[model samples]
Target: MTSAAAVASPATVRPSRGLAVFWIVAGLFGVATSFLLYLEYVGQLTGADPIVSCSFSPIVTCGPNLLSPGGNLLGFSNSIIGVVLFWGPVYAGVSSLAAPGGMRRWYWRVYSLFIAGAFLFVHFLAYRSVFEYGSLCPWCMTVWLATIPLFWFTVSWTLREGVWGTGAGTRRVGAAVYSWALLLTVLDYAVIAIAAQLRLDVIGSLF
Candidate 1:
């Protein structure tokens, strides 16, 4: 007998119902954020001031932040790209849940890559917003926050299922690195927010 017949391919694993729901929620958030950005863009083009539908807060104004040079990083609106990329994962996630055979391994692999790319893109934008732009867009920040957990959960799930690599040690190291980076990013944001608050308080006291 040929050695080729000695072994069977491993069975494919499907994501749990919980994971399916997580993906759906993440996709929806991405869609909502993109829509808000589009609205801001329309307001800008029409020379109309962007209106905040939410409660009045410094963090809620999309206009001042969007019109800044850093917002249009690629010389055009980032929302256009966000709309296109956000829907792909949404469709794939919903289809994965409904399909009897579940999503193929390659499909998950591709989806992970796409989401990772998006996570990185958003990370860059957030960094620019904090350091260079010095202004925040509430919708964009919401999307950014949503993306952090979305990417982390997806990558963790994929890694656990052995979709990313065959070596367990390599996967562990990668996961550790990702976790540390996420923690550091969160801490950085916290520090920035605290410092900003302190500075504002001090200025108010002096006036």
Candidate 2:
């Protein structure tokens, strides 16, 4: 006979509904924006005079960025990479929601690493848009918008759920970060907005 206390506990935790929903929405949004940009790039390459939907004005256009060597860093439109990468969060969200035990810790850690890379890459593109290229791509900004929150929330959730570790200090830090995730996301947006305003006078350019 085995004692009740001898049974092993389950290793997996249920995914947060809120975080899962965010992942779905943000991933879909990223995919849409990235696809749009990819289509525009394809049109450009094919020598078609397709009107770019995101090209609102001279200051706010995707033409230069799409045509620039920076956009083809990997010898293809960066948006093509975006189209592929954004699907990861969507799959994670869908599978985690459908699974009884949700996702494993290793899964989240790997996902977080990719998102961290995206966060860094997004900031680099923002820097180029502000200083190097001197034009704003609306679709690129949309991708940035989607990625920023996804990164913050995914990281916060991983921390709060013990994906990073199961220590008291780690949990405490994760909880603290989770509580401030939204405000931090807003602050990130503000940083980009302020930079654009300073370098490009985005508001003045609009008028």
Candidate 3:
């Protein structure tokens, strides 16, 4: 009979440097962008024009978005929210890296859910930015882009590892998703861009 250690598969292993790097980049970008928005919010209150490099055009403006009511949904800047939430992935990534044995499956499962929520939130913000306001915050877009792969990888990895008590069938499905997650991420960006291009003349408005 096969021993327990011999039966164990490499697919059941935890996250690697690739997944960690994805989170690190996502968290760092989110923090940076949110901080910039905070600066923009400060400038708004001060009646000073924020000198942001991403302030490219009327359609690609961060100032107006920061000054809008949406910027302060809970009596505070959403950038504050970004600052707080964005640190999660960074902590997860760093901790996973630091631990010699790597993080637990349940921990990764929870982290996956956290990133999934972030993915949804970012999409909502994207909708508001393009359709509602007809403006795009370049920094916010960066967070959105980072979140795509971060969410995809976490959840897919969780499922592949059977963290949710998944069996072989589910593991196979998860493995497939993990394999194609990057391609799906690129397509996601494409679909969002197409939607934006259809709704707003993003290119035309730029020039």
Candidate achieving higher TM-score, 1 or 3: 3
- Encode model 3's per-residue lDDT on 45-146: one tens digit a residue: 887777676678888867767767766678888889888888999998788667656656657677888888988887887888777888887767776777
Model 3 TM-score on a 0 to 1 scale: 0.87
What are the clashing pairs of model 2?
A: none
Off by over 4 Å in 2: 1-10, 47-52
Off by over 4 Å in 3: 1-13
Q: Which sequence of candidate numbers ranks them by lDDT, best first?
A: 2, 3, 1
Q: For candidate 2, what's the RMSD?
A: 5.7
Residue 184 accuracy (lDDT) in model 1? 50
Off by over 4 Å in 1: 1-11, 49-60, 170-207
Root-mean-square deviation per candidate:
7.1, 5.7, 4.6
Predicted structure 1: lDDT: 0.65
Steric overlap count per candidate: 0, 0, 0
By summed lDDT, the worst window of 10 consecutive residues in model 1 runs over 1-10
